[model samples]
Target: MPSLGTDPHSVRQRVEAMEKVLERMFVIPGINKPVGLDVILDIIPGIGTISAAALGSYIAWEARNLGMSKWQIARMGGNIGFDMLLGLIPWIGAIPDLFFQSNTRNLRIIKRHLDKHHPHTKTIDVQPR
Candidate 1:
């Protein structure tokens, strides 16, 4: 099995980059909310959620590598799964998917884990709002 990175900087860099791509790629006007590739890709219909879930799994996998408990990882997986399931719905799902960012939620979990377990490492600051 592969090991987690000893260097916190690399982990921070990776998680920050992914949070940007998955959650904060762009902001909505007026409300100033963040949105990312997952919502945009939903425009494609059936294949979009699948592709997005595939991309989102990377974040969960990283959480696993970082030594988060299986329950935590599973919760993260559930978040992603729920997002994908909702996204798969025809019309109603689109609006919610645009707003409910599972990736951002998962990122929060990762950050908390880092802050708790790896306190020596500076936490990555990739907030969605």
Candidate 2:
């Protein structure tokens, strides 16, 4: 399988797409709440929680591809872990997902790390006064 770190553009696009799905499809507009997938899938007993967990894992996978260090990966996993464990509760997990925005946060972290460490291939000259 191709690694995410090898292709930052594709990884970024995938993460952005997932965020859109969560924001647009899974969340409701009127009250500005996460009620679609969070509520319906979560109410489905075991599958709902598992599906959310899987979604979180997908984000983690992208983070790994983005060259996130081990520590960063662990932190990313922690976000999903909290989402899964707390979200398994009847009415609580949905609220957390609405507020947490784990994938979005992770994406930012990955971008920052990549920019700081790898940066772009092109080099810009700084003129000294």
Candidate 3:
């Protein structure tokens, strides 16, 4: 893990990395679906859901630091809240939790903010051969 920095570029990188860890870290065997700490952590009942929400909230906090508008931050919070609530459902929560990628959504919001306000931090995604 890298130290969180105050610059927009570093903040963008940290947020992207955190989103990846929370929402797209691995592919489930045989099923072909990606999973991350968000879904995996949901298996532990109350703690899992809360822990995942906390991690998700950290992204929103980063967005706040980037000077994102309240509307965007609220939407990000709503995404996390919905996901957290769904994850609280014991046994069945993980099923829905797998589909509702709050962190990914939040990441999209943050990216848009950074792209619009801090254009230099924008990065291109290159596919590996």
Candidate 4:
């Protein structure tokens, strides 16, 4: 694979962007207090859960584009599954997203996999040996 640094449209960037969206838009506000969107959109009968699941799926898709193996993709899917499944609960799931940070966890996994397999292709050397 070409160096991720040389490619501005690299999968790593896509994943990072998604992580940012999840953190800044959804997870962060949800944690500080009972945010309305996280509660309202999350509480709606069916559409809410579906919306969240779709957002999670987007993250998994980014993982797939990054050349992650099927196992890694499945793990990302599992995170979404957990988030959606638990998030359905009245108030429990929303609270967990603040702390669990599924997107952050998935990002970590993606970073680890890319760093391990494509160290030479990265722009930075933040990965620990």
Candidate 5:
């Protein structure tokens, strides 16, 4: 249910789901580490980083819809910028993509803001039903 002219529950769920899909979908078998389409896409040349960056923009959009401060949005953009720049490097970029997880990081920021601004509706279930 929406309150205060904001729909944090739906927004949070969608953002978190996309975060997992972008950064934590598949396991590396014996290594037991998770990697998603973002890292996989990095294997592709120019399109990978751009595609990942394009998808990452959704987090900033969600933050804007939530009425987050400009500074927060700027910080979010910086995160995406760093992720895109570093993830675009030739072969070495994949190493950072494995650890950077920008979408997850942005999700944390959104979750924090939602928790603080709307405590009553803060307990959003990120898992898809």
Candidate 6:
């Protein structure tokens, strides 16, 4: 087992940051809902869908590196696949992308795993005003 000072904590931080960038970077005006690169990428069609899926996969890859079970990784992959399918819906893709945040879901899975296996890596989330 490796020391908690490096890998687990840093992995958690990177994964969480990626999730925030993908799913909740800023709030959309008027709608007042958070949006991020995931939704923004969905606006670009084929390349967008591919980019979103790849970014989402990066989180899953991190989970794998954390030694998460194959089942959990599969579920994360499924979420990304479903999101990709939704992203293939032409102009309407961004609408669904706004709600179906695969990166956020994957992040939740990673958090649960970390919380249980590497509890020392946990930290209180302080949102900036």
* TM-score on alpha carbons, each prediction: 0.85, 0.71, 0.93, 0.69, 0.87, 0.91
Predictions in order: lDDT:
0.80, 0.64, 0.91, 0.65, 0.84, 0.89
Per-residue accuracy of model 6 over 1-129 as CA lDDT, tens digit each: 223344899899888888988999999888888899998999998999899899989999889989999999999999999999999987798998888899989998999999999999998977654
Once superposed on the true structure, which residue ranges of model 3 sit more than 4 Å away at CA? 1-3, 126-129
For candidate 5, lDDT tens digit of each residue in 1-129?
323334777787778778888998988878777899888888777899899899999878989999999998998999899988887886678789888888888988998998999786577465532
Q: What is the lDDT of residue 94 in candidate 1?
A: 65
lDDT of 2: 0.64
Best by lDDT: 3
- Best-first order by lDDT: 3, 6, 5, 1, 4, 2
Superior by TM-score: candidate 3 or candidate 4: 3
Worst 10 residues of 4 by lDDT: 27-36
lDDT of 3 at 112: 87
Residue 96 accuracy (lDDT) in model 5: 92
lDDT at 120, model 6: 96
Error of 6 at 115 (Å): 0.3
Candidate 3 RMSD to the real structure: 1.8
Write model 2 residue lDDT over 1-129, tens digit each, in one string.
233454665565576557555443654558655433534455556678778768767878877876678999998888777767766877666666667666556656766676676676223434222
Q: Please identify which of the two predictions, 2 or 6, would achieve the higher lDDT against the true structure.
A: 6
Candidate 5 lDDT for residue 3: 32
Model 5 Cα shift for residue 66 (angstroms) = 0.4
lDDT of candidate 4 over 20-117, digit per residue (tens): 66554532243453232333445665677667678767778777876789999988888878877767875556667565666767877888887788
Q: Name the lDDT value of residue 3 in candidate 6.
A: 32
Q: List the residue pairs that clash in candidate 1.
A: none
Q: Which one wins on TM-score?
A: 3
